[model samples]
Target: MSTPSYALRDSMTMLRRNLKHARRYPSMTISIVAMPILMMLLFVYVLGGALGSGIGLPNGADDRSGYINYLAPGIILMAATSGAVATAVSVCTDMTEGIINRFRTMPISRGSVLTGHVVGSVVQTMVSLTLVIAVALAIGFRPHATPLDWIAAIGLLALLTFALTWLAAAMGLVARTVESASNAPMPLTFLPFLGSAFVPPESMPAGIRWFAEYQPFTPINETVRGLLTGTPIGNSGLAALAWCVGLALAGYGWARIAFRRHAKR
Candidate 1:
């Protein structure tokens, strides 16, 4: 086989291995998926009224359905981040185990190992995102988006998933243990709260509002929300794409460096 063929075969093997691991230990993925759903239910049922009123819902009235529609995009992003955290923990575990050393001694492509984790994580993220969206739809989260808007939203999500999964893989490489790896991605999970995920950034205090408006998550959130609700996306879509691409490149470089250093040690 050619070099490319060999790499593809090796990567596919690793991808299957990772997928099997996910199947055997489904708890992590389940927990990741559950968090977003629970948060959605909590906010929509419990806090929706107050938050809707505070945000001044469309037509100048509080409505849970309106809030649900606004909140679904953020929760979907949360699901993606949570899945990334799962990737970090899984990668950390693989690094700590003897299997990675064994693979290094074999003829398999080195980069395939990282590729497997990233691809698997992205798949898992997509599943979680789908489930969250299904739940949102079931709960009266109606979107006014056209088919083109849906395509754009999915594309944006795929990009975000790729970037975040790679970053999580880097985090895994940097962590000495699975516990640390698990914790490393926690801040990402919390980032949505600080962005325009649930409430308008303008409603926040001056300092907080500045951070919310300027942060990467805010633009991404806004873009997704706009795509779903027929709101004008303006420059947010471009900003979100830029952030995803930049982070992906940075994380890919970092992961490669970390892996090389680990191999040397």
Candidate 2:
């Protein structure tokens, strides 16, 4: 076969492998749906009433449902974050199973194997995000922004997931054992809690406040929130995109180097 045809075949083959991996344990898909629902319910009905005043706005500026406005974006970020949890474990599983070593012998692009996994994860994560949004709407979450901003926010969420998934890929590559891979995502998962996702950064401690205000997740959370609430957020949207793209490049670069070197060995 010609070189181009071989590469195309390899990417498609890897994509299918990723899809198969996603189905290997059906409970993974179930947990993805269930966890976000639990978080949305817990935040909306339970903590929301107690913390409603902290959000400082009704659902749609004048619409009494403001809590949903505040809670919805937070849920989206958290939902996106939840999707990265299993990445490390899955990556480690590939290494453990000797499949990656098998791939090393093939003439395919080494990067495509990792890219395919990320592609599959992104698709699965978006599906989870869609379900979470539906539950939020059924519970009274509404976006005040025009359809454009709504689309932009979802686009941003996908970008956020896209980049973060690469970081997860890097962790999977560098981690020494399957167990460490399981623990790798914990730090990334904890990040949203330090941001405006759950509460306004101004409400946090000065030390924590400084961190939250400047962190990448804050802009991501704000951009999405501003979109949902029709609030004015200016350059921060660009700032968030920059962060996502930057991380994606850095993570993918390192992971590609590692995979290439590992394959050569």
Candidate 3:
């Protein structure tokens, strides 16, 4: 068989292994999925009225529906980040186990192990995002995007998921234990809150507003919001694409190096 064919087969084998783990130990994935949904409900119902009123909605302050429209994009991004954490934990588990050492002794493609975790995590993230979106719709989150807009939104999400999954894989590779791996990706999940996820960055204090606007999550959030609501995306879409590509490349390199170092240790 060709080198590429061998790599593909090995990668698929690892992918199936990861999927089986996800199927058997679904509690972790379910917990990750539940966090974003719970947050959406809390923000939309508990705090939506006060926050919606302040965002200059035409429907006035009582419009939780309008708030949902504004909040859904950010929440979706949050869900993606949250789901990526699972990849970190899964990778960490594999790394600490005897199976990883066994694989290193095999003739299969070395990269396939990480690829499998990344691909499986991206798939899980998409599923979690879908569930979150369904809940958003049920809560009256109306988006005015066209078909192209929807495509763009999904594309951006896929890019974000790919980038984050790679980063999580790197984090997992570096961690000595699953506990550290699980905690390492916690910041990714919390990053959206520091950005414009739950509220407009403009409403924040000056220092926070600057950080919020400058952060990677903010551009991605803005791009999603623009795609979904027909708002002007400006350079945010470009910025988001750049961040995703850059992070994916960086993370891939880092994960490869870390895995090699870990194997040698």
Candidate lDDT (C-alpha), each: 0.90, 0.80, 0.90
lDDT (10s digit) by residue, model 3, range 150-225: 8999989998999999999999998888989989989989999999888888889999999999999999999999
**Residue-by-residue lDDT tens digits, candidate 2, 100-207:** 988878777776788787887888889899999898889998777788987899999999888888888888887888889878887776688898887788888899
Better of 2 and 3 by TM-score: 3
TM-score of 3: 0.97
Identify the leading candidate in terms of TM-score. Answer: 1
TM-scores vs. true structure, each candidate: 0.98, 0.92, 0.97
Question: Which is superior by lDDT, 1 or 2?
Answer: 1
Q: Supply candidate 3's per-residue lDDT for 149.
A: 93
Instruction: For candidate 1, write residues 1-265 as lDDT tens digits.
Output: 9999999999999999999999999999899999999999999999998898788755333777678878998998888788878989999998998678999999999999999999998998898899999999999888889999999998898888899899999999989999999999898898999998899888999999999999889999999989998667799989999998998898899999999999998
lDDT of model number 3: 0.90
Clash count of each predicted structure: 0, 3, 1
**In model 2, which regions exceed 4 Å deviation?**
1-5, 58-64
lDDT of 1 at 191: 94
Model 1: which residue pairs collide? Answer: none
Better of 2 and 3 by lDDT: 3
